[model samples]
Target: MAFQCQRDCYMQEFVTTVVSCCPSELKLENNGKKEKVKGFNVILKDTILFPEGGGQPDDRGTIAGVPVLRVTRQGAEAVHFVSSPLEVGLEVQLKVDWDRRFDHMQQHSGQHLITAMADSMFSYKTTSWELGRQRSTIELDTGTAKPGEIEALERAVNEKIREHVPVTVKVLTLDDPAMEQVRSRGLPEDAVGPIRVIDIEGVDANMCCGTHVSNLSHLQVIKILGIEKGKKNKINLIFLAGNRVLKYAEKSYTIERALTALLKTGADDHVEAVDKVQKSVKALQKSNLSLLRDMAVLIAQNYKNNPNRGNLFCLHRKEGDNEFMNIIANEIGTEETVLFLTVGEEKGAGLFLLVGPEEIVEKMGPRVAELLEGKGAGKKGRFQGKASRMERRGEVEALLQEHSRCPHLEE
Candidate 1:
């Protein structure tokens, strides 16, 4: 086995919380740009704070009472940048947010266990692992793993978490003879030092260079978000860890309460409540559609009886959905050449236009369209446009009646 000398890595502490934290190892000397004051991560020889590596988010908390913005690894070193510079050599008692740390542990350890189970059961390997803000995921090498297989693997992994297995962290060199035992050699190429292998005794073993809880009991729960086909032969899994689980629980509770109150139902009666809501919504929609149809008929009947019908009768109004205008035009269009136009439901707003027969449109469609003004235009022997206000209706109707281009064109 290759020995890990302090000189080889320039940074490596075999013991945990043993080395002096280099809070001012500040790499970016004169980065040319200045920072807006405080809040940053730091590097320490033996940091109790886990950095953002191994698909896990970094631990967040106060270092000597100063808030730690984030934790990250610089090469082979684990660093913790704090809000204020801690007294250089002072060994600040590092405190990690247990809730956040534990949640990440569950998701991370859960991923290893599930991946191992998948490999053992279906011979499907885990390609990669990703722990997101709200969810954690492990991509399996194959999509052929059935739902039953997924269920079995999930059950088995959760069972392992429940069993509270011992997570052993063994530091080994690259030249170690025992590398053959590592089933998951998922190591990054740049990790060229004493590799820390976290072995979930009797279950999963993988070469990982990330912070982990001492025991599996720290992981309270492993929630599987869902599995979907990613690429050819690849499956993606999304899941949530630690405090995020509590957040999700709270969110689900809020939604449940709102839904229950809205449906006038109890919390436990969700399915029936949903069914009731669907039925009620459908009934209301039917009633609304019926009312709309009646309104259209009524408007069209009036436009027909108006008696000031002209060949180029354009009945454009901001009444309702497009169906309303079409309905009105269809109703009166059958009796006269009517061109109905408008922008939307707000009456006296938007624009309007109307054109009768091709001959009539050619005669006065352009002139009327010009008078309507404000970015309105029509062509193809049709008067078409939107108006700035509803007052242009008289001008539009007068134009059509005076044009009197083609009476026969009224269809």
Candidate 2:
């Protein structure tokens, strides 16, 4: 086991000797394939880098200026994985990423206080917790939390923070009478030796291995974002603490400013304004679709007057969609005509459809898709699919025209 500083978590620097360093490789199985990754596993006599555990991320920093990529715990040892190797018995300098460490400390400590407060108030024990980059979540044992209950819990947690209670850690044996008295989530069956407990003055004490802030005041404030349903009737409480709360407020203000200007409304009226705009946009879309349908009918009537029309009628429209193509074909209302229509610009790919007699469609639909390097299917006399190789679409049209004139040309 490594010697933890125990004095203060904010202690940023240390000098330690490398106990051992090994050329390490991690083997991962992905999609039935074995992959090996090259790295180094390092051990130090004393380290300030906290390994990733207890639902909190590992501390990131430098070991003698070489980047420490990851850290993990095996038994009592905290293994530091590095990109480059360090020699055994070499004395080196260590540095911790203070900003990341402090942020984690705030969130983890805030979670502890919140969990304690909830358990005390309503017997809602914490099942699990996750510290995320933007927000954190605490899963409670209960299925639901009303808005009033949530507000009260937030108030109680913030009250503790304002009290500026000192957060202290104690190390004790399993047999110690204090062990039975402290509130713990419980210990692992295989656990041995001394257990570390975090005490928030008179509020609560629980066994925790994660780093924390020295005082509750450092938590700044605890804000409950919302509560969501979790697995098997549990409630997941989303929250932000300390610097995260300030960051969230800044982003919210920026978005609100943009919305107010775009909607020509005050900040408080933005939601109402947005609702009105959405209704207007939906009505406009319905009007445009009706206009397109009317235009399709006129085009089909004009095409029907052509004396040069053959068994195959091919058309392309840059602005057309599947609905437009289908409407025009249905308006023609002729069993003598076979329709091959494509939409979207020639420079890009788009949708296409085939409608004709069942025999002709079954024979030619697959051929068209093959030539266009796309896919489709048919039932009755209709086939539809997306085509990517529209640059060769002219060839598809010519082939269909030939087959329409002479059904046995290439068979």
Candidate 3:
């Protein structure tokens, strides 16, 4: 027998007897952690909740007041996963989530209309399709769509929707003559009983197990968002139908309003304003780099000119980068003096460089990296790497001071 959902897509409530309830484990994610939740797989005599199949997600609702986490097709049965179990033969009221079910119906039926029109009008074959959370996609066999072809296709699809074409379901045997006319992607090996076909009036006839709306008017409208390059020799057509189109438009408008306020520009000028801001930021970054290089040279020259300055020198710059540190090291000359330089937040993550004698740098590099919660490597007389605990800068300076005092200790 056809499942109650497949039999009547419009049914919202139904009374059914529990055929079986088996103990099962359901995996759930909570706060980014996966947990095995104990549950029961309840099989009913018939169900109004559609199972996961044909690229449509399973329906979510309640069974006997218990939340149904998932519904899956096992062989020819719809198994509803619930936290509580119902006794066999016990009658329970099952309520389908009307909003989710209706949304799915709109998208599924919309796909049929689109598939048929694309094939008839442009010779584009739908190889596969997916009903996503916010939108849906259809993978076409062709690698590219001709200019204006998608726009024309969208017009054709909406025209059918406005026509209020009727959509009906038919159950036929494998040997039925009409079965030869329906488009199919083959049946599952475990598929049992007769095949169910969805007929979109004079538009399309396809063999599908998923539930759909009864009329094209129910689709409200379908908007072809755009196309994306798919796998080899294929293109994915992205679209939203019915309420999804409205929701998408609402969200897009909200974002545009927010951007308009932030950029102090109208919606139509948002792209140009953002581009201008990006160019300005790039120019400022270039100027900042040039200034940092100049400052590095001056700092190194200051240290070199100080005859009374100790061999140990330490400096930290919040805006410094690797290039700045290297410039200072090269200017000051690391042969006779130890240079400890760090760049970034004083109490957060940053970069560090230590340059001096080869032996001293090699021996102190690992120790200093560990103290700053970082790792580094170097040959010759320089060591540098990233550090996470820039607050430990004082401790590093102290260690460098002790090493300078006892120069032979590094030997």
Candidate 4:
């Protein structure tokens, strides 16, 4: 039997007797965590809420004031998952979410028009389609579209919408002669009753189970956004219909205004302004790196020239990198002194390098890593790695000082 939703796509409310309601559970993800929710699977004599099928999402609404989370078709029955159970044999009111339903109707109907025009004009067959939340897509059998083909296709689809063509449904038996003319991807194995064919007068006739508008004008308009490469030798045509096009435009305008304000330029100059800013940032970064390298050499030379400087030396730079630390280590020479250097935020995660006698470096490397809440490995006379707790550097400095004072203790 055809569902009431399939029978009357425009029906918003219907009174039906509850045939059955049983305990059920729905699995859902909340904030990246998966959880199971307890619910009831309700079956009604008929429903205004369409079950998920034919690439259209299930309608969300209420059944006897209980929220319906999902609906799916099992064979001949439409199972509605609801928050609360409805008593068997009791009459209940079922409501359809009109806004969502209408949006789907517009997109589905628009797809039919586009598919027909593409096949007629370009010999491109629609192998598959998806009606998404933001935009919809139809996969064509061909790998590519000719220049101006998409624009022509878009113009043709909108012209049909302007024509206000009548869209009607026909219920035909399996043996009906008219079924031969209808386009189909073969009926479902468990399909019961007559097959429903949607006819767009003077355009196309296709077998479809989903709800649709009775007139092409209801589509308002169809916008072919662009094309995307698909698997194998197919191309997916992206598009927007009715309210979705308006929503997309509104969002795009909002982003444009924000960019214009931040760049202090008009929409037309946004690209050039961003490019110029990026180039300037890159030049500044290059200059800063050169200065840091020069500073590293000067600091190392100062320590080497100072005869009064202790065997243990420590330094931290907010802007130094691994290369800067290596440069300093090479300049000062680690044979006679223990050099402890760090780079990045003083109280946060950063890089650390320790260089000294092989014995001292190997023994103190792991301890320094632990105090900084990090890890490191060393061989010969150098140790280095990333540190997570730069705030604990004082502890590492103290350990190094003690080692320098009693250099023969470990030996």
- Candidate that would win on TM-score: 3
- Between prediction 2 and prediction 3, which has the larger lDDT? 3
Clashing pairs in 3: none
Considering every candidate listed, which one attains the maximal lDDT? 3
Candidate 1 residue runs with Cα over 4 Å from true position: 1-46, 63-66, 77-95, 223-226, 238-258, 264-269, 300-319, 325-411
181-236 per-residue lDDT for model 4 (tens digits): 99988888878888899999999999999999999999999999999999799999
Query: Which stretches of model 4 miss by more than 4 angstroms?
Result: 292-411
Q: Give me the runs in candidate 3 sitting further than 4 Å from their true place.
A: 29-38, 84-90, 336-339, 354-383, 398-411
Local error of candidate 3 at 337, Å?
4.4
Better of 2 and 4 by TM-score: 2
CA lDDT, every model vs. true structure:
0.63, 0.86, 0.94, 0.93
Of candidates 4 and 3, the better by TM-score = 3
263, model 4: CA deviation in Å?
A: 2.2
* lDDT of residue 129 for candidate 3: 97
At residue 294, give the lDDT of candidate 3. 97
lDDT of 4: 0.93
RMSD of each: 9.4, 3.8, 2.9, 4.1
